[model samples]
Target: MLKHTDIWRAIDRLAAQHGFSASGLARRAGLDPTTFNKSKRTTSDGKLRWPSTESISKVLDATGASLSEFVTLVGDGTGTNPLQRVPVIGYAQAGSAGYFDDAGFPAGSGWDELLFPSLGDPHAYALEISGDSMEPVYRDGDTIIVSPAAQIRRNDRVVVRTRGGEVMAKQLIRETATKIELLSINHAHPDRSIPLSDVAWMARIIWASQ
Candidate 1:
């Protein structure tokens, strides 16, 4: 006996547990930052504005929660609790070096941890994209889940880290002994190829809002 209200309640609880406002959760999931805002939950006519399936999937990935955990969160029937604050950084800023220490962890102030159902794996991060540079494929303000431990395969979407300490997300077109080819999602941008030696590290993109 599933109801739309139950889903909404689950989302609300997840947001609270992560110490994010409903809108904040929505933003982290790469949907419209206002999609889950309290004001947007109810329509102008006062009817409930349900969240979409796509949005739910993105939220799950962002929080590292399995679908089963989401169901329990929804059915817990307990009142929403406040979320614990953790450091959050935008996708553009996360690309820069020094933001993370030598151990590849977030550093410095203004950081807060987002709570999600335990997934056993501890190395996960959230990245928010900006601008239409990668549009039609990844829209502005979309949040992406990056797992550094995930294996990278050809044609997989990945976040590439260069020797210069820059990060860019693109599709891996091909890999050879000497170079790597990357395809840009936005047609406006041309594909790129670089020597394998220049690459520092790459993380596969498991999920994205767009």
Candidate 2:
């Protein structure tokens, strides 16, 4: 029998493959952004929550993915190449101490897990968007996959953390030996230029559910 986690993992992978987070997938399907969030996977009383067939049907319409394809994603997911199972957390909690190592990998507990098509990254993790700080592009409740081990490049989407424990997801504009420039994904937030010394670490955002 297909477990609840297995079904959810398939939905997450499906969203990721189509450049969406679970919330984005929900939005695309005309559902509330939080419909697919991990926090909704269970009830306040601790009972398992399953995705409604209506929501799943909406997602299928939005992604143009057949039920068979979703089934393929939910299967062993270990055929020719094994899927990479990545840890996940909400972006609001990303700056909390002990959730990440000095190198920016998921370290402590409080993380959920999801399977993704191989990205060859052992340090890859997902962060769920919490607010509209990155609106238009990344709205509230969208999820993004970050690869700490991946190369940081100009013009790439990135997640940057400051020594002060601030975490931001933005577009990389320029990076020099002394400082880096970043463009805001949300137009309302002005661009930023911070000294390299102020940065704890910067990781490339390989994928996002938009």
Q: Indicate the residue-level lDDT of 37 in model 2.
A: 94
Highest TM-score among the candidates is held by which one?
Answer: 2
C-alpha-based local distance difference test score of model 2: 0.82
lDDT of 1 at 197: 90
**What C-alpha RMSD separates each model from the true structure?**
10.8, 12.4
Query: Mind sharing the TM-score for model 1?
Result: 0.57
Per-prediction TM-score = 0.57, 0.66
- Model 2, span 88-172: residue lDDT tens: 8889678888778888888876568776656668889999988877887777876788998788778999999888889999999
Candidates' lDDT values, in order? 0.72, 0.82
| Runs of candidate 2 exceeding 4 Å displacement | 1-78
Candidate 1 C-alpha lDDT tens digits along 115-179: 43332235656677888867776778777766666778999988877778877888999999999
After the best TM-score superposition of candidate 2, give how far the Cα of residue 33 lies from its true spot, in angstroms. Answer: 26
Instruction: Find the 10 residues in a row with the least total lDDT in model 2.
Output: 74-83
